[model samples]
Target: MSTKTGADAEMDAGGTETMTVREAIRSALREEMEDDEDVFVMGEDVGEFGGVFEVTAGLMDDFGEERIRDTPISEAGFVGAGVGAAATGSRPVVEVMFSDFLGVASEQIINQMAKMRYMFGGKTEMPVTVRTTEGGGMGAASQHSGTIHTWFAHFPGLKAVAPGTPAAAKGLLKSAIRSDDPVFFFEDKMIYEQEGEVPVGEDFTVPIGSAHVEREGEDVTVVATQRLVGESLSTAEALDGEVSVEVIDARSLYPLDTETIVESLEKTGRLVVADESPISYGVHAEIAARAVEEAFFSLDAPIERVGVPDTHVPFSPTLEEEVLPGEEDIQAAIRRIY
Candidate 1:
């Protein structure tokens, strides 16, 4: 596995290329669209505007309006349309501008998209991929900055993935697009420009339900998702010889890699579950619960959780910085656990 914290590694002559998380995601979409005719993208201002985050930039010129279609500013309508399209036959990749806006489309996402296959017993398929930007920073304010991925991760029938590195972003997204199930791909807006080595191949895909041990050590195991993954990695590097920290990126939130985390805990005997979501019954809670359930004997300290203190993300920049969890938070958690 690639170490999470490192200098910007240039593209080797081999199969991997250095790319930002945004570029990697765009590449994944382009490759997937080229491979499958059924795959199409639709969202507000996605075609001409290149999406709110510009992750879909230059796709329309390659695939034309039919494949890279733009939709009305109605999350419920377009999201429901994507679900319908998926049910019929097409593999639709629908982008919701902000994950915070997903609440407006919750009916389509939770009830219809998530349950259609199961509701139909074993006959139907919901090959819909919902891509949305998440997390604080960029001062998107309370509504747009909330890390609400825990809702979908906890909800039944939806596969949730939040990529930490560029490689994870590309691979997990390809996997999500190719999967027959509905997958919620949460992209942390703050990490779009973060660079990493990404495998360059059409067949390159990171399987859903897998966790990568980004860094290996013997003391505390820090299992983090999305933005926190990098933060935790940096914290681990800072600690260095002082504390042996094992950093694991919880890439797939729903089908979480509990075994990987459990194995790390078995060796390290301490854990810190960190994510940008709220601390109250969020991703941290779930990871902590799993560790307690499976690795009780390995526990040397109470599991520490680093996340927002059960509050909505603040609009003010100072308050946002204060409320959002980061490398310092991970460091503090590791210290506590150690």
Candidate 2:
């Protein structure tokens, strides 16, 4: 495990004050738009309403309506327009109100934007960022609260990034905006207001495909993504004397930092994956399969996965609590493997 020190370390305004995750993202977009002439923000309710969740709040006033254009409630049409604009030389950050709405514009994303560069043999660059809120925790119900990052991660041509911290959120958002490829930026709906220290000024980018070790130990490795990172950290603290568990955040899903995971497994000799998605054919399944195939010789026991049961996200709070992976589930998995 490597620690990002010196310049890589997040410093605040005057090298003292810190910013939140949402604020960091806001700063990134603000700075990028200010510095670049072609950069603009567009989507439904992005302008006057400042977005459904206000992620793009205040940008409309700052950048003006021409840059922060608002469109109708047509996901397919606006998404397609963003793709076309990106291909034609504009840097457009398109917001999908909910990740579940991606299904409505799958053709524009998977078929058009993702395949554009390769189809044109690298002659064109689709520099489009599809920003959307994902994951569950609030009472958003099934249709609004699914962890659909895996759907985009499954695509080869699109870059998938999920930031767990305010700093990661800021850095990764800048990197996604600058990239010449289509990026699916997944922001956990619950973490929107979760405060953390973030850099205040200048340009910084957290390179995609890199994983962060949130907490280090020698007994077992808990590989988590998005909100699961918080759960894993809590589980690690609770099981402090009982077992040693290392928590890793795979911030970027498609460009998964599997090498880091395999290396950690080599030291710990055990592994567990905690995800919000269902256990079957999900991100946890992919991680489990990769660890077994690549690090089987180092394992002391079978790899385990803690995730929602194989079913749609429940609307009832009781059923939802029962289905979601929690600290108890993570502790049980750790104890079983240990």
Candidate 3:
């Protein structure tokens, strides 16, 4: 990771600076590729069409087709190729297009890329980054929108990271590219245009297994991931004098920062996990389990989980909003906990 002073100096130039979350991600990839000859991006429509969401826009002209190669709609084939490339000393960033499409390449991800290091007795490294978008709000339907980070986190030897802001996205993506293990990077489709203060320039990396404290309070602790962090923050503000809610963004789900969460619970003695996934066997369950194991003595009441109903994500806007967790749901959970 680069020093804060250096990052600030790079951002001080100030020349038409605002960028969206998607644009910041594109910039991170561009900087990493320019710095390291071994780093290359390969995925569907990444070369000619600039990716499905325009996240990889105009990379083919800059780095040429070789580094920014496009491929058929074969998730299994290309994902396996990426895993092979990583083992052979090349850094490959594979975009799975949509999180729902990951099922087509699950074997390559779970068995091959994830188990390579252990299967080889730590003789080889798999430095592959699988980037994909998930969650609702774009009317992407059930197949295109789903928060399945918990599934990847359940697997060993792989890391899962979901950034809630543009700055975190850029830094974390850079870190993922340089990692020696496979990573599942989940991006929220709704936050594509969401903007934040990202320090410009190169060599900026946010380490994995760390959580960010978005808001400080004393009554209750709300742990959230991805765009849910934004919703948690809004709910915190709305509670105002009624409740002192602290928001903790669990940026990395796999190597979770349980220490931060436990410490926050020590002060607040109440917890609420706000996740945008199904309630049953989801990330919130893991978090609640950990809190119980580590912070049971500190907790004043039963831990609460704010998440979607245990049903498939609906396509209708009204039904989807009801099914998914929102600010009001979080607020209600906070009231219960506090």
Best candidate, TM-score? 1
* Clash pairs (backbone) in predicted model 2: 21-166
Steric overlap count per candidate: 0, 1, 0
What TM-score would candidate 1 get against the native?
0.96
The TM-score values for the models, in the order shown, are: 0.96, 0.94, 0.94
Q: Report the Cα lDDT for candidate 3.
A: 0.87
lDDT, model 1, position 94 = 97
lDDT string for model 1 (199-223, tens) is 7778788888888888999999999
lDDT of 1 at 111: 91
Candidate 2 has its poorest 10 consecutive residues by lDDT at 5-14
What C-alpha lDDT values do all the predictions have? 0.90, 0.85, 0.87
Give the lDDT of residue 209 in candidate 1.
Answer: 86
TM-score-better candidate, 2 vs 3: 2
Quick one: ranking by TM-score, best first?
1, 2, 3
Candidate with best lDDT: 1
